[model samples]
Target: EFLFSSLVETSTAAELAEKLRADVSPYWAVHYRFGKSAANLSATALAASSLDALLINVAAPLRYAYLRQQGTEDYRERSIEFLCGIKPENNRLVRAFGKSLQPVDASESQALIQLYREYCERRKCFFCRWGYRFLSLSAR
Candidate 1:
């Protein structure tokens, strides 16, 4: 059982991600952000992978190592897998923000906040539904 589990764990998720990159690597491009990875899918061009075992927490949204790679205008409706953290919290904020959150489609619903409020100020002004409502008003 140990050997089997080890074999399964050996396959990193990045390998599948790399394969996804190869099929559409050279022809694609991203427009915003500051540096190289900001415009490219990632470093190392991805690596080979196979999945023999999987582990997940279905109760929470997923996370990605390079979370900033997720952009608003890229796709219309999508859900992310293989992401590594707390995503449902983001989803809650977006839901409260309504349309001012533009690119309000399902694809980008679980994005983390770009700017965070001060910890001393209380998460009330930071992570609350009211905060999202406030941001939505200004974004318009």
Candidate 2:
């Protein structure tokens, strides 16, 4: 909500950074403690994990969509490169997909997610890479 509300068509990196900084609330820092000891708790305003997840799932995908719509390859490739740079999020879906192939970064993870959602779930084996390979062989 905060990101989309603040984001504009011409938003700059500095502007986005400022919005993130401003959106941070200090109430948690003053009121909350993780454990009996303060040493175990985080005092920072920003949650690194949450931010990383947002960047991977939201920002990168939106960037790819925008770049793809513009019919350009450079920035589209850069967006994928950004995804490839980030670490993959660990979850049941990712783990399930990992049974057959390992995802080295967010790009591979995202690709696997798309494959599962669009092809596997729909049982569109003919459209999937591995599935297509086996299907072609059996058709011969």
Candidate 3:
């Protein structure tokens, strides 16, 4: 309920993180204990955990579901925009790509991620935009 509500209300990644921290952290402390976990954790730690859950468990699946249902170029673009708006920094894949380059704005980062997901990870480089360009240059 909270996760769905947060997604509906928040537009940006930072906003989602903040909302998770504010609204979910208290309940998280009580219900989210792991084996032998500390009885008390700082607010920061709880907030981080909540943010991770929202991004990974909630947002990512929702984004993919939207893409599967819509199945159009425009919808794909919108899904990417929605994912990018949600704190790409919190995502390990995005962070790794950021380190490889000097910096990447949200759109560039999302594009790279999309490319990776759709082509690179699938070993479909021949069909990838960058791969196609590289292959064409090599052929020349």
Q: Give me the overall lDDT of model 1.
A: 0.35
For model 1, how does the per-residue alpha-carbon lDDT over 19-121 read when each residue is reduced to its tens digit? 3343334434332343443445553332322111122222112322122345533222212433331122333444554566643322334342322323213
Q: Quick one: ranking by TM-score, best first? A: 2, 3, 1
Estimated TM-score per prediction? 0.21, 0.60, 0.49
lDDT value for candidate 2?
Answer: 0.65
Give the Å shift of residue 102 in candidate 2.
1.2
C-alpha RMSD by candidate, in order: 16.1, 6.1, 5.6
lDDT, residue 134, model 3? 66
Alpha-carbon deviation at 8 in model 3, angstroms:
1.2
> On a 0 to 100 scale, what is the lDDT of residue 87 in model 2?
73
Specify the highest-lDDT model's number: 2
Q: Which scores greater on lDDT, model 1 or model 2?
A: 2
Give the C-alpha miss distance for residue 113 in model 1, angstroms.
8.5
lDDT of 3 by residue, 30-122 (tens): 454644445665453545645655664577567557657656556555555565654334466556444544223445555667777888689
Cα lDDT tens digits, model 2, 16-115, are 4345553334545444544333434455556655655776777776766776777765776667776776677776667866566788888888877777
Candidate 1 vs 2: which has more TM-score: 2
